[model samples]
Target: MYLKLLPFFPGRVCTIQDPLAAAVSFDGTVSTVSDTSCSYSAVQDGYSYNPDSYVYVDFDAHPTVSGFVDRTEHVFKDTGADPVTCPADDIQGCSFGPVTDKPKEINDVGTLALTTQLGSLTFNAILGVNQITTLYTDDTLLIFAPVSKFDELGGLCGEYNGDPADDLTIRDETVTTDAAAFVTDWKTDPNCVSTPARSMLRYHDQTSLCSGVPQETVSGFEGMCQDIISPHMNITDLAKDECLQILCICNDRDIGACEASLEEWFTTLGIVDQRKKDPLDLAIELQSAFL
Candidate 1:
């Protein structure tokens, strides 16, 4: 999706896609969240060294389904370290600068809490309902959804609408097997070009690692990770995929690290879920048992 400019705040806009999304501009304006779609905004505090920034949140009863946010974009007057081209300004756009930090992910058990660079965003969930109360924040941007929407949403967070069958739903509402095409379809702006997906082909070794994994190992992990949701594929299937990726990167001697990464994968799967308990607690327990 595209980041739409907010008229109330100059140089500030809300993303129409990723739930854990952020788009920044050079212009001076406070950040906030608008009721458009899956979006977030940040307000820059007057501090120079640590200007506490915060994103506004909505407190609707029938809450919108915003997936977990893991993506951020910043617009700079000029290109700097690791620049990604943007359609608005050919100079620079979609920078992951420290202006906004990643929000800490929670699970779908009880309350909603997402920690951002600026501060914390928290909200209490109503009992037996799919909505949350007004969000209380310290100085951060956070997103949440009802437990009823668990794995029932889509967008930049992946094709996780509770269906493990189709994870690559593009912007045109079509399913694509091609990774580049999938990324391209999510772009709300036509002039914008997707990042160099093809350029990273050389580093991909998961294909080889996918083979020879024990079925019991996969089933066991999947059984323990039932709470986590896989965005692009079935949790069972994703377990295998993550297994391959983890194996590709971690050596045999680094089995503990691999287990830890797997535990992280499980926790991350529920990061966007709006129920309650911290995914890390489950992750820690899973690690203790499996590792």
Candidate 2:
């Protein structure tokens, strides 16, 4: 009897290797079976097959048979349905495991805040915060001030020593229970800016300051994370470059020479000299100092 062989139809189980290099052996029946291929319908295992899926079957030997003969015929043999085994070693760029080493702690007090406060006080004799220098001139005469005073408030305010969450405080005999009254007394006093009391009260309105010395308020990790997350908390590269340019101009004592050097640096960095031909702006744009 010359029996015509029927091509393999849907419902045939097979194993396949996915494009992601994952070897998956499925014991499911195939669907949309065609002369060349079919879709896998996983039943015993959790796997699916599509047009892209390939099944392990030798058609030449079984010209009459249409289904898979045995489980071995599948691409991946039955390893007794268990969880897919993974490699023991760590995978690069994969954050699956706990961090072995903690990140180094960074100071919470930003350099910009410290620099602005110290720089303004040292250079201009003014107390400032957030780059806004508020000079305590006679126009804004203090109505009330601390009764007790110090020669300089320099040692009073600088860097935070404790947690960043806490306010910087200055502990001195001058600090009184009534801040307004204290200020009024100090300002009205004739010795406000004279010997034995020559006190320069630099007020940082926005900043929170207490009656104690500044202490670190944030941990290194917290500080670093804050800086990384907040751009305003730290000084920008442009500012640093501008400061450097200012220093150079001062050292050279020639604005024209400084501009020439700055222009050259900008050109090498492939940056436009914007901000009224500010070299620091150009450097900041390029985000590098290759020159």
lDDT (Cα, 0-100) at 272 in candidate 2: 16
**For candidate 1, lDDT tens digit of each residue in 111-136?**
22221211122221111112311111
- Clash numbers, per candidate: 12, 26
How well does candidate 2 score on lDDT at residue 212?
Answer: 29
Q: Model 2 Cα displacement at 199 (Å)?
A: 22
Worst 10 residues of 1 by lDDT: 2-11
Each model's C-alpha lDDT?
0.28, 0.19
lDDT of 2 at 211: 21
Residue 73 lDDT in candidate 1? 30
Question: For model 2, how does the per-residue alpha-carbon lDDT over 1-95 read when each residue is reduced to its tens digit?
Answer: 00000111111111221100011111111111111221111211111121111112211111322321111111111222111111112111111
For each candidate, give its TM-score against the true structure: 0.32, 0.14
Model 2 spans > 4 angstroms off: 1-174, 188-229, 234-291
Off by over 4 Å in 1: 1-144, 147-153, 196-241, 249-291
